[model samples]
Target: MQLKLAGLEDIEDVLTLHRKYQIDTILEEDKKDGFVTTNFTREQLTKLIQEEQGLFIARHEEAVMAYVMAASWQYWSVWPIFARMIADLPKLTFAGHTLSTENSYQYGPVCVDKAYRGSGLLEAIFEFAREKMSHRYPVLVTFINQINTRSYRAHTQKLGLVVLAEFEFNNNHYLELAYDTSKSLSLHQSTHGQH
Candidate 1:
């Protein structure tokens, strides 16, 4: 498997994977696994690749098995949920720093193929995106819907993201989580020798 930033050429494959788990189109039974709320279009994805440089993916045999999106608050502020998150940043603290746009970036809507759920691909791809974004920001922030226990556990238990606060947006409850970018799984792996 390969983990790297996604270029424009990879958008179609990413979208194909996204549609299978997106909230609107996902199968009813599949919701328990997890679902992505945002439905990104080709135009939006193009901007994400060219401007934000924030789309990361994990590919195996040329298939996009998983993807993670991370970008500045400004890039995300257009969405109401993100706008609210941006306004609440200063009130939350993590990793010995007061959160703000200058010091942190929003991450999420990560999707992994069901076949690879328990194989540690999530941690690998997540850390790949986090390590790259750390060059510009010291912190990474993301919000997961309160009902999505699958995602909450994966992030908190597997990836070690801390829940800074919980808030309601448009009547939907969400858990806001953050991670210190300075900490890398590669470093952790090097010391513990875990693949």
Candidate 2:
């Protein structure tokens, strides 16, 4: 299978994958707690992709596998008004977020097709982004539910990431992981001639 940045052509697959996760599984503990309803629209994802604050996806001769989005990166802002608006939305899992966040680019809503669960693609997703994120964003932060052992393992064991802290909101625990690029990290090595 092949991997590449998703374009307009993959909109349908991307939307399908997003909806499948948001609607089918109890992705967010907030939903189970009765605080918000998880929801996403194709228009929103399409617009986000156009803005280039995240990475969209497509697979080799297959449906869109998944997507990975930077928490607050390029072309992004922390306007209080925008923050307030997002806080009040349905399925607002990231309830306690603020404009005065911290250093690093946080990652959100990483997902892969259910059919490809054991293929180590998730690790590759981090590798793909980690390849350049060291300099692009400097620090990459992601909040994975502490109970989600699979994600935690991949972030810590497979990718050699470090757990910085844990955050709690709406009774859900999220492990904040960071990619420290200060040392001789191979993640910073150039891959221009690889095939």
Candidate 3:
């Protein structure tokens, strides 16, 4: 598998993978395999890619196998839920580092194709993204649905992400996770290079 930051030319391929694992397309029993909470639009993705905000993809034989997105708090306008998430960021911290809109970026909506789910590609993609993003921001933050055990385990266990806080929004419970970029990378080195 090959991993790299996505360019505008790769937008369509990314969109295809996004749709394949989108929540609406997966069945309840199949959800354990994987699912995406958000469906980013072409326009939004175009802007993100152009600005180099964060959209990393892993590919095999030219097919997108997995994707991870990282964006600044300014993205809150694109998704209302993020506005609520941003409102609570000031109350959290990691390794003595406070998470503020200016110093941290939003990370999430990661989607890995089911075929590569257990092969460590997800961790590799995140590691690559963190390396690229950490240069610009010191913290990486994300939220996972309380019931998405598959994602929760991968983020907290496999990736070693720390839970900073949790809150309810629109009736759904979510766990806020933070990673002190510099420290998180060093601590997860063993697992980061797997596969």
Q: By the lDDT metric, which is better: model 1 or model 3? A: 1
Q: What TM-score does model 2 achieve against the real structure? A: 0.66
Cα deviation of 65, candidate 1, in Å? 0.4
TM-score of each: 0.94, 0.66, 0.92
For candidate 3, write residues 84-193 as lDDT tens digits.
88888788877677778888889988999887888878878988898888898998999998888889988887788889888998899989998878754546656565
Which is the leading candidate under TM-score?
1
Query: lDDT for every model?
Result: 0.91, 0.54, 0.83
Off by over 4 Å in 3: 184-186, 189-195
- For model 1, residues 1-195, the per-residue Cα lDDT tens digits are 999899999999999999999999999999999999988899988989999999999989879999999889998888888988989999988889999999999998999999999999999899889889999999999999999999999888778788999999889999999888998976755655655
Global Cα RMSD, each model: 2.0, 8.4, 2.4
* Arranged by TM-score, best first: 1, 3, 2
Ordering by lDDT: 1, 3, 2
The regions of model 2 sitting more than 4 angstroms off are: 23-39, 71-103, 181-195
Preferred candidate (TM-score higher): 2 or 3: 3
